[model samples]
Target: MSEQFERLSRLPLRDDLRGKHPYGAPQLDVPILLNVNENTYGVPDDVRQAIVEAVSREVVGLNRYPDREFTELRTNLARYLGHGLTPENLWAANGSNEVLQHLLQAFGGPGRSAIGFPPTYSMYPLLASSTGTRYIAGRGNEKFDLNAEDAAREVRQSGANLVFLCSPNNPSGSALGLDVVEAVYEASEDAQAIVIVDEAYAEFAHSGTVSALSLLAGRERLVVSRTMSKAFAMAGTRLGYLASAPEVADALRLVRLPYHLSAITQAAANAALTHSDLLLANVENIKVQRDRIVAGLLQLGLTPVPSDANFVLFGGLDDPHRIWQGLLDGGVLIRDVGIPGHLRVTAGTETETTVFLETLGALLERAVS
Candidate 1:
């Protein structure tokens, strides 16, 4: 712990929060950053101009709090997501992280339990903890893919109040099939659990991969969360939202702070959505790079998990951290998820992807020698 955090920790803290670390990916300064699955290809100039213009229009409104309901913003998001959703079916916050926090605040609390399949998003358990919700660590197969039967069984057994399923799951980049979603929903019926399908990377999934959104028609207990951060390249904006029944969105209103979204945030995200096509233009390029990384790793004799998201998780490393540091020394940074002997790297531009692959190949060559 840092000296500042140590001093802070000395003060009385929540008993459960004591000794717990914050969720973070290493924010390193390097020539190539593949650590977080960020769209290295930034906002296009035209879209940036639109966002600036949109925020300018909101400047006078800075005197007033933003729309507590975020009406127009939700409409834009609903239209973007399609599947015949409307503002009534939507709720958004600073990021998917906050959106999730809101869900926990509303439906998850002391005595209730939540569960997630790992190597998944780290925030699920953290969100549960912060809400005083008991968190259960669920499992997946060796490849990190949770089949329908296995996933449903865990839900039936855990009897959790909230369950998170990350489609095109983080770190491993494997997506959940709709069959799994349906099965888990059926199994959770007896327990009356809320099944949350986190689609943070949904936009980057390969074509023909059906989204959990398709399964949301009559499933009142189901929520499909999405974000502008990943494929939309708006990490700086921190806008995340979800689609569910109107009742679910109504429940969030009880817990969300009034006017939580600033005028500027609403403006920026609304502007980005205005040019959704332009903003999402790079998704194809990123997918190309993601596949390139997988192929490159396979050729290097490493085992890469087949990915549908914009990053690849690979294994077969003798010393994952050693290779991680070596890559950083070469000015490339990737993620060493706590999974032993495995590392994850975001797919960047063609050149950045080439640098990462070439760097890893050189490191492997050195290890052999």
Candidate 2:
């Protein structure tokens, strides 16, 4: 048990959560923040103005509740995704984390189990635990690469009722090909699993990286979840949604709180989607920095995993903590991610990237000579 468990011993805390810690990264007040994989660029002027106007309009109607279904927001999100997706095929929540939570509540419970590959999103297991679902830690092949056959085999072995596939997966920064998704779905036939493709970082994927949305045509068991937090430059919006069979939305309705999405949130998200073109312009710049970080790491004699997301995970640090502390002391903050000799850094603005690379290079030089 954790030290906190003793402090809360008098209360009726859940036994499963005895020693658990909440999921979070440092929110330090530093000059440069390349951790947390957030879009470092602030919202564009036009988009910011649009969100302001939309939210202002909702203030007058604060006395009334938000749309129970968030209909307009769903329509806008559907239009933004555009893989023949309609509002009826969409669902929304406070964030993608909650979207996953709702799915767990609707489909996962005491008798159900959920599975995901390791070194993937940390939230998958946490979300599973929150909903009383068993979390199965699956595996990846060499260098954290998972192929169709290997993934399918694991799913069959786990017999999980729900499966989370984090595309352009977190920390590793690689996406799963559609074949893997297809094979996993096929393998899950006997278990009747609900396969979720977490495309939270899809907008940042490299050239020709396919998305699971293309495979959702007739698959009632597949869901493609997305968020406005990454390339959209709307992390403050806290909006996450999914495209699935219409019946899935109906299932969620039974468990979600009334007016879970507020009027202000719907307005702001709808406005942001209308200006998605301007918002996505920032994604191109971030991708440039991502590539640059990979190349810079190579020049520094470090190994940067190939990435389709806005961050890079690099290895070869002699003492990971020393380097992490060195960077922090230099006024730049990145993620250690608890991996030995490996750390993850989000691709920030050009200036931020340059400083990070330069700062890290200096530290490496000092460590050697």
Candidate 3:
């Protein structure tokens, strides 16, 4: 623990939160950063111009609080999601993390427990703990594949109040099949549990991969979360939203602070949605780079998980931290996801991808020699 942490720990703290490190990826000033799975392609010029104009319109209106209901924002998000969703079925927050926190605040807390499969998004546990929800560490197969039967069995057995299924899961880059979502939801029926499919990276999924959004109809307990951070290239925008039954939105309203989303945030997100096609054009480029990274890793004798998301996770490193540090030393950065013999890297531009693969290949060759 750092001196600051030691002092902070001295003060009274929640038992679950003590000795915890916050959810953060390294925020270093590296030339190429693939560490955080960001959409490094950035916003297209057309969408950028639109967002600037929209935000400018909101500047004078900043004197007033943002639309407390975030009405127009929800309308845009609902239309963008396009499974016949309406504003009543949508909710938004600063980020997917906050959107998740809202869910936990509403459905999870105190004696209720939440569960997530391992090798998944790190924030699930943090969100659970912060909300006073007991966190259950669920499991997946040795290869990190989470099958439907296995997933449903655990949900059924745990009787967890909130089940977080991180499809195209973070740090692994593998997506859960729709069958898995269906099975888990069915398993939760008797328990009346809330099944949350965190689809932050949904837009990056490979062709023909169906989203949990398709399963939302009549499944009042099901929630599908998405973010503009990835495909929309709006990480700085901090806009994440969910599609669910209207009742879920009502539950969140009880917990979300009034005027939570600022007017500028609402306007910018609406502009991005208006030009969703332009912003999403770069997704194909990212998918290409992601596949390229996977191929390069395999050629270098590393085992990369086949990905549906905008990043790739790989194993076969004898010392992952050493490899991570070596990459950083070479002015590149990727994630050391704390899995033994594994690390994750976002799909950057073609040029950045080339540099990362080259740097890593050289490091391995040198280590062997």
Candidate 4:
């Protein structure tokens, strides 16, 4: 297997992809899994039972194709989002990544470019590359924050046909202000670009952090994408959706394959939506633990970025990879997100959080001694 995989890489591949690595986080089996920003709490028993019932109902209908447009699932998603949206204003796929790929396919291609403000979600650039779109690197400040002015400047300068902004950004966890979203949308007017706000982590954001969905009222060029993978505790279900103008949703239809969503997937997500409140009950608890992580990292004299998501990114490490390995050796798994001198850990359950903090504290103490 290893020899064949190595040979495959050496085969004639896309020149741009020749030396590039695939996107992945270490999937180690550990006592405490604080990587990947998954909800530590599993699906509630009530929601699980409801989903099972929903899926069972669709079993006999397996011979038929899922709704080509997934009407019922879209309506349920619209109801969950609650911005006076209808199925016309929604689109969904196996994951937000696919939803995003649809957008790029419709608006971006050879000779057109897309821009993403980094240390953002790594997939934005990868998506651009895979779709035969030029990837333009946009800048964020030293603290990895992108203000309205800088964002507007990058959009205008890059002449980007698509722009991606990840709020409660991964590896940083800071939420982008709505003002930034508005500014970037306005800036992209000349380029006729589509702006995508990847809010996969929005449910875990601190209160008062507004979603870009609020800005979709008049902005036909704006898209706010979300997923069930994070706070919804439905990562394995793989349902992601986006909200935009009805016209934008129509554009996505031209690019998406027919019957892209499986009947089982639609049933599972719809049933989960019916029990939305119960599924989201753990959000506040996760927020509490996220705050605890920030405070605990501070007490250890590390520089932890203030986060609006379930994970915390911290710096001031002499060797981030070494510390990551040390934590893994202690049976706690976290992410070393290629950021020099920094590491990120998800806000796990209380006991898991305790194990992570205790293990790291001991390591820090040992280093100091």
Clashes of each: 2, 1, 0, 0
Angstrom error at residue 162, model 3: 0.4
Which residue pairs show collisions in model 1? 94-238, 168-175
Question: In candidate 3, what are the lDDT values of residues 16-107, reduced to their tens digit?
Answer: 77888887888999999999888998887878898899999999878899888998889989889999999999999999999999999999
Give the poorly placed runs of model 3, Cα more than 4 Å off.
none
> Taking the tens digit of each residue's C-alpha lDDT, what string does model 2 give over 179-210?
99999999999999999999999999999999
Every candidate's CA RMSD = 1.1, 1.1, 1.0, 1.3
User: Across residues 1-369, which tens digit of lDDT does each residue of candidate 1 receive?
Assistant: 588778978899999998788888888778999998999999999999999999999997789888888898999999999999988999999999999999999999999999998878988989999999999988765578799999999999999999999999987999889999999999999888889999999988988899999988999999999999999999999999999999999999999998899999999999999899999999999999999999999999999999999999999998999999999999999998889989999999999999999999999999999
> Clashing residue pairs in candidate 3, if any?
none
Report lDDT per candidate: 0.93, 0.92, 0.92, 0.91
TM agreement with the true structure for every prediction? 0.98, 0.98, 0.98, 0.97
- Weakest 10 consecutive residues of candidate 4 by summed lDDT: 1-10
